[model samples]
Target: MQSSHVDITKKSAYVDAHIHLDTYSGAAQAAIIQLLEDDTLPLDYVVAVSMGLKSSQATQAWARRYPQRVLPAYGFHPEQALPTDAEVAELLAWMDVHQAEMAAVGEVGLPYYEREAAAKQGNVFSREPYVELLEQFVQRAAAWNKPIVLHAVYDDAPLVCDLLERHNVRKAHFHWFKGDADTVERMAANGYFISFTPDITYEEDIQALARRYPITQVMTETDGPWPFEGEFTGTVTVPTMVRDVAAYWARLQRITEQEAAVLLRENARCCYGY
Candidate 1:
């Protein structure tokens, strides 16, 4: 978990707008958190999003331990089996109790990968329940007036957008987004933010997105513990990887890498309010 020894002084500082810090091992988490104290790195803060109640608790603890660097977000990820009614209630109640500490309600959205896999296996995937669950989280985010970090993409993006619109929740960050032109236009028009991961460095589709989407509504993330290909094939994914992401994004947007870094960092700060 050592820092990627890239020289970042040439680039403007940036933030990992979305990451799952709790998913890393204890030692890896320690090493990563320790790097945040190093001023030489371009990394400023990491928005650590949670997977569930236990994950949220661990994220909160990390935030407490490193108050200046870790910005914790609490919510259940939608890729797994649905929680029971009591479990859902418990998570909601716990989130309410720690609402003041959370940077946003996040890692929440409809399950695209899971659904696709089920369909490929000739199984009927029930989406209504997932939609209902996302609605509950959206309602809470609206009530708390907190920004929301989402895992929504493709076909699920429009449905999630509907819930956001219904609840009048505008501060939405769609992490690692991939969707059609119309959905992109809708999200951009609504002023919702989307973050690019290291894959942007080599993925033509992601690069195309960086060009089509408004630069002002964009940010950078690692989604660490989720490896990448291309130039990052063997390296441990870290926050500093965003520097390269920003560099590639700048090339696409016809801007300086430093300028892209600043824009992306500000966009994240504006959306997450950290």
Candidate 2:
């Protein structure tokens, strides 16, 4: 595979702590490839998160293509149907086998948005099975000593927090986090990190969280391939947007964009050890 020409000499190097590049279309994926080769884009490293087995495999391919620029994280997403134990074991074993190339075990957590969908289907969504699944991943993270990226948010955040505590996993990053004050405070106290997406630019609650949470524990993410609203609406989600998100955090925290950018970038590398 050819090495990426993404320049790291730029004033500020940004790290996208969470993005699902495999979820993008062929053209979008090609665009990223071109960006990496052009040396104009201001992206330093991207942590590509997986939704399932196939996503993880595709992510690994990208990581291989851009060894220095792309970091891969593998795990199951919460909103999807829970995989059986055998399937879950297969995925975890695959991740472990590729642990030498893996950045983390991630994109895992409880389903916070499945209730309404379950109601429409005339079936109740059970949390127990998902909890069991999450426990398995958490155990793997602990055993491997790799940071775990989380999809847990809102009311569901506390449950995931409990599991993390039970497993004694300290290196956890809660991407696009949206939860209560108590949960946020506990997470902060426990030394867990939280990152904001482009939504922070217009979302009052996310802005508030940015101000309340210590900047030392904050990071930035595009959650790319995941659309956004407000100013980000109609824009293709990309790592470049993390620059603007850092600026927003700067204003909210009363710091310069350069300072915010550096801190956030370091936070990413610190959490994922990339």
TM-score for each candidate, following the candidate numbering: 0.94, 0.92
Superpose all Cα atoms of candidate 2 onto the true structure and report the RMSD in Å to 1 decimal. Answer: 5.7
Stretches of candidate 2 exceeding 4 Å from the true structure: 1-10, 120-122
Best by lDDT, which number?
Answer: 1
What global local distance difference test value does model 2 have? 0.85
Error of 2 at 136 (Å): 0.8
RMSD of each: 5.1, 5.7
TM-score of 1: 0.94
> Residue 138, candidate 2: how far off, in angstroms?
0.4
* Alpha carbon lDDT at 189, candidate 2: 92
> lDDT tens digits, residues 1-274, model 1?
1112223355478898888888887766676866877878878899999999999999999899878688999999999999999999999999999999989998899999999999999999999999999999999899999999999999999999999999999899999999999999999999999999999988899988888887778899999978999989987788888888888888887766766777777778789886
Q: lDDT score, residue 38, model 2?
A: 59
